[model samples]
Target: MEPKAHHVVIGFFTLVAVAAALVFALWLEKSQTDTEWAYYRINFDHPVGGLAEGNAVLYSGVNVGTVEDLTLAPENPAHVRVLVRVDQNIPIRANTKAGLVLANITGSMSVQFTGGSPDSPVLNGSRENPPVIEAQPSTLTSLLSNSETLLTKADQLLGSANELLSEDNLENIARILENTRAASESLLQSREDLIALLEQFNAAGARTEDAASRVSGAANHAREVLGKLEPVIAGLADSVNSLQPTLERLDRLTADNEKALDTGLQGVGELGPALRELRNTLRTLNSFTRRLEQDTRGTLLGEETMKEYRE
Candidate 1:
């Protein structure tokens, strides 16, 4: 029997449909790994605790990639290794740290990344040897550990408090209370004196306020006086500045004539001795004149007549 043409067409369509489905399946699988991505490893000392693959890898709270795989470290089986694939554009640096944090009260845990400084260089790695982001203690681990420590400390504190509050201590506490009550009674007895003292202090404070007001007024008056004198002071400064060139010229003239001035002063000093000698001669002549007046013949004469009169 000859094959029907419709059967051939149906068979060809079936093959085409199968091919299309396979291509779509492949595209979907490749979509997850086809992007330009960088790989990083996170080695945690604690167990994964339900943290599994396909979990979100968040960079500072924003989803940047997904956990690709989880396995134990080859070198140390005690450590859990998490392989993550992040967008290549997301800068991973040496300081970048990874930690497992619960998404919310009941949600699954996610890997969080921190420490991406703008100036820090990008961490370089490849699939063969990816850069490692050291895993910090999980939030749950830290909380539980800290709570245990706090409980221990609280127990110690309670024991110490119990020891400090023994029978004798209770009696001492009662005595302290009695002393406080007596002190309170004594304060009440002197209440009026205390009130008078407070009143005096208030009066002193008022006097201080008055003194401060006076000082403020004086300061304001001084500021006003200084403001009024500012223009006068500026004018004086300008006058001095304007006369500077004349002073400088006079200085230069003095420097130039210093030798001549010194010579004139020296001549004046030399004239002093001559003047003294002339005074001596004048005194001698006066004595002679006095003798001459006493005798007209002595006046007509000179030193010989003066000498005779002296004798």
Candidate 2:
């Protein structure tokens, strides 16, 4: 029994559709895996809590790849070596850091990448041997890991506080507080005296400031006087300098004429009495000349002259 033309057409179309669907599925698989991956190694010295293989890797909060494997480092058993596959598009730089992050409060964690500078070169590696990326400890991981230690310390602190706040210590503290209260009350009562003292201090400060201002003014006046006197002082210095040559000449003359000056002084001293005698003789000569002149006049004047002369 041969199929009808319409049925045959439908069957052929169905086969073609199935084949197309298969091809699409294969292509989708290929396309999904077509993204190039870069492998990197991270060594964590701390426990990777809730971190597992197949966990999503995020780059700056965007899912970029997945964690491939996790194992204990063969060389150092204390370190956990984590192998991650990141998208080649995401620049896993030389300075890239890897750390585990909590996805939710349920404690599910995933590998995350952070701190890749733009200037850094892209980190390269293969499946056989991947480049090592530094592992950063996350805040949550550190808190969780140190929870015990923190609790222990907190317990010790509480114990110490309890011991310090014992009955005797509490009594001492109460006494100190009472004393402080009394001091406060006393200070409150002496408020007026304190205010008076503060006013006195203020007045003293004002007086001191005024004195300082006067001193500064005096200093300025002194500077001005000194400035004005500078030229006068300079002129006096020049005068003294000019007198140096004259003084030197005088000194030389006095030294050269020492004996002559002594003789001249002695002669002048001896001439004093002689000079007095000469003066007296000149006076007498003047008086004689006058008398002689009067006699001559009387002779020439005859009787009237003789009568005046007799009188």
Candidate 3:
């Protein structure tokens, strides 16, 4: 009977120890730290991965707080409300961003605070509102949603490309490549011709330089000749100046001769009429002389002289 009693006592103490341990754990979970802390709420439109009460809240990767509660937001049923207890001396500014971050690959998540502007006013429960940030989709979710369509399109494209690379088509492509190679060779040959042309241009430039030098020398010779001729030209100019008065006198003499020629022409015109009158007078005299001669001849001969006197 005493053994049964001892066994009962042992069982009772064991149960009491377990109960005390559970109570101590509950107290540890519910108790606040000695440091003063304040509560702020962050709202998100989706589940914040595995974030729950007692999850660590970090500011710039340093743990500064803990999540106090998580519940669906009353005002926006689609969103969730997360209550965080942060240290009162943390100096959280209004511009601080709270983001849900995956803590590890096991799908656990936490709320992280970063990039608080120092000039911004400190946030309080009454004045603070949750900032809506851009949401990022998980890699697994994105891949699951679009992988089939992407793979299907990729497969079709690959099949089409394979069909395009068939042997006859490949031969045609080879021919095209060969033609391109020939064109490239032709271009290279043309480049050689271009180099020769540049060489010719250089030679022509040398010739032009030589011609320019010859032209410059000829111009200098012409200048020297012109310099030598300058005095001769001046002397010729002086001679022309000296002959000017003589030329003027000759001009006056020529005018006087022209006037004399005009008077001579008039005299000749008058003499022509006088000569014509003299010719008529001569003709008449000649006729008279011939008659006188004939009469004399008849008288001198003594024939018909008595008849002539009776007449």
Candidate 4:
């Protein structure tokens, strides 16, 4: 009987020690979770793929706290609200940004805080309304969104390519290629003619160049001749200018003697008739003198000699 009582006592003490240890552990865990902690809310506009309660909250790559709860935003179903607890000593500023980051290869996620300036005011809120840390789309979310858009565009491109390579279009392309080949063959056959045409064009261009050179030389020669004649033309102009006064004086003299010159011309015409009448009067006087000489000679000779002469 005494041995059984001793065993009961030992069992009781052992049970008490285990209960005390359990209570101490519970208190330690509670103290660790609740002491010097602050609460905050983060609103994410994109879907949080693998984030859940009890995930770590990191501040600039250091683990500071853990997420407590998650719910859809009351005002908009598209947004999600996440409640978190962090160390109260952390200087969560107004400009601090929050985002979800990948934790491991299993795609586990955690909330991360970044970008707080020293001078920014502390983020503050009441117990009922915790300060909201601005949330950004996770890298995975952005990559997925971009991939979806790229796939859609690729599908459209493929559809267009299919239409472009249809049977009718391919047939048209073949016909164009056949026509181009025929044209190329025709050009190859006419190579000599094309070369001859090119040669003729080159000859014509050379002749045109020679003609242009000759014309330029002729123009220069004409300019030189005109330049040489400039002085001769100037001398002639000077001579004409020097004779201008003489020509004017001759004009004035002719004007002044116009009446006297007319009277002298009239007198010369009247002198012609006076000279003819004087000649006729001199002829009559000479005839009378010759008759008187003949009579005198006959009287001086004897009357008998004159009679004999008459017989």
Top-TM-score structure, candidate number: 2
lDDT of each: 0.87, 0.89, 0.79, 0.88
Segments in model 3 whose C-alpha atoms lie over 4 Å from true places: 1-32, 50-53, 74-78, 105-107, 117-119, 126-176, 187-194, 201-311
Runs with alpha carbons beyond 4 Å of true place in candidate 2? 1-36, 115-129, 138-144, 240-311
Candidate 2 local lDDT, residue 46: 90
The digit string of per-residue lDDT tens for model 4 on 1-311 reads: 99999999999999999999999999989988677777899999987877899999999889998999999988998899999988888878999999998878887889999988999998765447799876988667787658889899999999999999999999999999999999999999999999999999999999999999999999999999999999999999999999999999999998999998899999999988887887777777676556546665544553322444554
The candidate maximizing lDDT is 2
* Model 2 lDDT per residue over 1-311, tens place: 35688898999999999999999999977975998888988889999979889888898789988889999988888789989898887788888888888887888788888887899998888888899976989898899999999999999999999999999999999999999999999999999999999999999999999999999999999999999999999999999999999999999999999999999999999999999999999999888678668786654555344344553
Instruction: Show the colliding residue pairs in model 1.
Output: none
Ranking by TM-score: 2, 1, 4, 3
User: What is the Cα-based TM-score of model 4?
Assistant: 0.46
lDDT (10s digit) by residue, model 1, range 1-311: 34688888889999999999999999977976677888998889876665789989999999888998899988888899999988888999887788988876765789999877778778876777888878989668677547878899999999999988999999999999999999999999999999999999999999999999999999999999999999999999999999999999999999999999999999998998899999999999999778778888745854354344553
Q: Per-residue lDDT for 255-309 in model 3, tens only?
A: 8799788999999889988999999999998986786687876655656644545
Candidate 1 weakest lDDT stretch, 10 residues:
302-311
lDDT of 2 at 281: 100
